[model samples]
Target: MAPAQYLLAVRRLRADETTPVPTGAIAAELDRSPAAATEMADRLAERGLVEHEPYEGVVLTEEGDERADRLARTYEILCRFCRDVLCIDDYEAEASALVGTVSADVAERLAEVLLTDEKAPSP
Candidate 1:
């Protein structure tokens, strides 16, 4: 999936925390223009990452949570590699831009290395 789409999915999951995440709450958290969060939420629902109920907050489906968790883990691993091995502190933002283009094999390889490298800096 595209990085922005993944981010939107993750954001929606975040919004579905203990307290029901209001559309306005998501909008504030994402700092998006008015209704942008709702629109993104709609797209996420269409993708099965989130489900919206009339007059109620959004919730993540089991599949949605799993996918979001996987994306988040992959992104974290990417950031660690870009920072620890590549000596880049701005890895989070850079990795965010590159995550979409990174191949699954490459991400898995990077994740393996990051998991084994005890000294790898974690974000």
Candidate 2:
């Protein structure tokens, strides 16, 4: 989850650009120490999910980008469910939803229901 979140953050920061994302930027986004962010980045790089260059920051590999996007969408869907269906607060919804795993198919179904249900809150 941490890796996916990091990738999503980097992807958001690099939207419409291919420039490498700075470690400091990632650390700031994740609210982690620079050293911790770098360590995680290194692990991701080892798995071929990202390319981490010392002092040059990191860039998500193709696989990482796709997974990150999926994770972000799943998170959004869960958050919406929590907010509209369960009446959870925004902050709690986001945090609570991510703490548990939700499969892509389940998330898609939830999103479909949210979109089609008359009583669902506006997206």
Encode model 1's per-residue lDDT on 1-123: one tens digit a residue: 342544444555463454445666666654664377677767878888777664565676677666665566567677878887788979987777776577656777776665575642332
- Top-scoring candidate (TM-score): 2
In candidate 2, stretches whose alpha carbon ends up further than 4 angstroms from where it belongs are: 15-17, 91-100, 118-123
Locate the minimum summed-lDDT window of 10 residues in model 1.
1-10
Worst ten in a row by lDDT for model 2: 114-123
* Steric overlap count per candidate: 0, 0
In model 1, which residue pairs have backbone atoms overlapping below 3 Å?
none
* Candidate with maximal lDDT: 2
Whole-model lDDT, candidate 1?
Answer: 0.63
Candidate 2 lDDT by residue in tens digits, 65-90 = 87777777777677777777777777
Superposition TM-score, candidate 1 onto the true structure: 0.69
lDDT of each: 0.63, 0.74
